[model samples]
Target: MTASPSKLAILTFAYVSLCVQFIFTVGFNHQVHHSNFRPSPTIRLRATTQVRYIQIRPGAQFKIALFADLHFGEAASTEWGPLQDENSIKVMNTVLDDETPDFVIYLGDVITANNIPIANASLYWDQAISPTRNRGIPWASVFGNHDDAPFQWPMEWFSPPGIPEVHCPATSSAHSGEEECSFKGTGRLELIRNEIKHNVLSFSGNGPRDLWPSVSNYVLQISSSHDPRSPVAYLYFLDSGGGTYPEVISSAQVEWFQKKSQEINPNSSVPEVIFWHIPSKAYKKVAPKFLIHKPCVGSINKESVAVQEAETGIMKLLVKRPSVKAIFVGHNHGLDWCCPYKKLWLCFARHTGYGGYGNWSRGARILEITGQPFTFRSWIRMEDGDVHSEVVFS
Candidate 1:
């Protein structure tokens, strides 16, 4: 039977709409069920990949590489041209060869999307950290808010018992009854845990559950393997969920942090470093004077306000703790460093995978920490090789 032109057009539109919905549904479902729930690819690459070396003063201080916000899938191209995975791999390989540090720490936002496909995130992590893992150097990572929610609960397909199951709103609308609504206990959390266990040096975070200790954050401490009594460095990996969307750190996390801080140093000698996805309140005070009160230029809404009140609270906590040295963060996606409070530096690293408005270059920071003082060196990848930014920190 032949249909009229009007009927045909209606059918076509309906078909297109259904197809679009189907794609979105599949993508979303894939993210919830599979994201962070599998083992990364086992690709065997050459061990000779070389990275540029930047010599630090004294030459004896321990080096710690800080890589944040890779945002792998955010790029337009599947294979990020020279600067991304390729350049990153080469640089990491070289760094591992040159500076055999005790271990490495990734500051979060390993995956690009808030709801990334499990395969994409897994593949990205596999490629990104394969070099480090292959070398046997332990690396640790914290969860960025983007690495959480709206995807799946208890993302624990790879590792069991690490994540606990929690009830979240069911994603499937068509399913009937409570059984259809609830997700399998050990799916999403396992994936993230396994990724961290296999790829990271150490792993700690509240998976699938409402951000543990805090709402969505955790703290990590690194010490000298040789001398436990010797003052080493500490990292407070705070989860500033997403952006300034008005969220508060849970009371439990705050209490935990306070207890941990007290235990770290009764006298407080060990230097501490805080890593958060979003810059804290102290960051704005310390933000380059030019960035402060400056309107969000270009397409970004000027009145949105960059810093949030919760940041201030976070800063207050840090300020109270004399051991904290600096707060490292991403999300703003620019090069800006500030020292608002006494003896505290708010450092922002450039994004490695994605670029900001009009800023297309890919870069990251390598931080070196000794007993009391620390240093940071920035690197950018150009056409020939990676270029070192002249700015050095002490």
Candidate 2:
């Protein structure tokens, strides 16, 4: 049947509307930005200039500082209080000053989006890593569930045609929380890539270019300083994906991990470590109790548990890959345990950010990796500079 003029008009209007929306989205994407905050030190560091690969000669050891859940800019206006986020940064700096790690890896949830405006987010986020950048230390990171969550007080949309259709203020309508708002605000993917481009000291990998939608997956090869091609170890940074994304790593991501792990050039299964924001399913097996901070030969302190049930393939792959000896993660702010999950030790970095749910003393996990036998030792470096959760990888 032939459509009436009215029907034709409606269809035309709909098509035009969609086209206009796309244009607006493309145009506005450029406008959204984080505020003026210098993350780079006086001297801008480049990933290429800064040493990414670690070359562990015969008896030498590589020290790694793992800091997790530095949930900056959270609860800016809560009774939970002020300086919570600042305190986390302060703890990070103290650890850097004292230990002087060879490399630092932030295990996600780097920033809490709630109660924050999109523009001011950089101020708090930059502060979280200023210590490492200022020290010119090589650093990398993975994403957590909260990294992309909307700021606590996200910018509200104005009335009329200019009002944003997505990530609009939660109060745009009757929704009690920003969760109901279509607007997701800026996520960790963009924020992280920006740093990689701007800061040379940042070694955080941009996720798989062909297979991924966001920026939380990539391999940071720690090769011998003498020979860039000869890798000493490989660090895989995977996004556990939460908040706006699924809470688990996808099967595709697992396949990608396997592909990348296998493609370590001539070196297959060379010593490696996995850093993600969330723990794998195996973590729950031994993490039932919250143990005190004391590093034993086997495992160390145990905090509350938050396991990733969907990580079966990755865990299985670890068993097959002898090169991967340790898998470090953060999400359970109260937990800092490291136990074997088959072949590799499933470890947690001590929570360093005060913005998260835990009040447990802020701390970071310091790793000492030695070559030859390829064994390693680690301990929790607390905010007060005391050490705990010390253990030698079995």
Candidate 3:
């Protein structure tokens, strides 16, 4: 018996619907696959349900690898720029594989914002930390002068047939959803917010509301491996001002530090280390006069210390606290030495990114801290897997 016209029509509609669904599914998957090749700064990865704690392993030392001045996305429009970024990644991977650090610290200048034409600098920021995140190694970040600098157009772009017109995605009905393809670079707040929201493994914080403009001014406590409840050491990250503001630690920041240090670590009991981008005026006071030898151990010292605009009370406060064993920074690409200053040591991270101006070899500064006797040691791990410039400060 042949089916009625209505039944026949219904059957045809069902068959077409199935075909359409199949096509839609395949197309959606294809789009996703291609997108993985491009930078997805906001993409969320597999994160632990609970916050992971940075701890010293039992009967073992806690090791941290510091990669500074990565300058990711610098000269992104040019050929040489991308190549430099690739080399920077190789350096990070090499050091990570060799040392297998428990934690990674992006000392600063993670992205050269002035060189990036795109409105969102997070694309480069994501790239800088991907190496650590990929390996399931927990990490933290502090911003640098170049991280949120105002966009600077290339001189050549203004030449020739004048500035070329560009188009970006926009709303179909209204201007509600549109892409901003402007020279305005992403600021410190947006960059830090994006990082903390997407990556649970990231221990970075936006600090306090009072400390506006300086978003990265928080403290991280490394718990004792034996006792998770007890903190063995503390790591303080300061937003040594730069980029959109004066390149100096503000007096307000000094006040915040004083209060936070007392609250978290009163009586100067716990061993603490500080990390920031720009060197303070105190660094200049202790810098090697002629040769970087004896008390100071490092490979390169070709340039003078690029001190901050002015000397705030941060250095003086740090000097008073004997618990503050050492402070690390990475603004000067040409210098990487640890000199004794008062009660603590002042060190510069080896230039780890190829995008920055420097012909010297690329490497990261490796720091190891033992919990039992409380010994802090540092050294440089080059891209070629060579290690040198070892120093100990207990």
The TM-score that candidate 1 achieves is 0.60
- Model 2, 268-387: lDDT tens digits are 646877888878787777563554433313233444577764764877877777777888888987677777666778778888888878567888899987654556788888888888
Scored by TM-score, the top model is: 3
Q: Where is the poorest 10-residue window by lDDT in model 3? A: 10-19
TM-score of 3: 0.84
lDDT against the true structure, per candidate, is: 0.45, 0.64, 0.77
For candidate 1, the lDDT comes to 0.45
TM for every model, in the order presented, reads 0.60, 0.74, 0.84
Candidate 1 backbone overlaps, count = 22
Off by over 4 Å in 2: 1-60, 78-82, 151-184, 265-269, 288-303
- Top-scoring candidate (lDDT): 3
Better candidate number, 1 or 2, judged by lDDT = 2
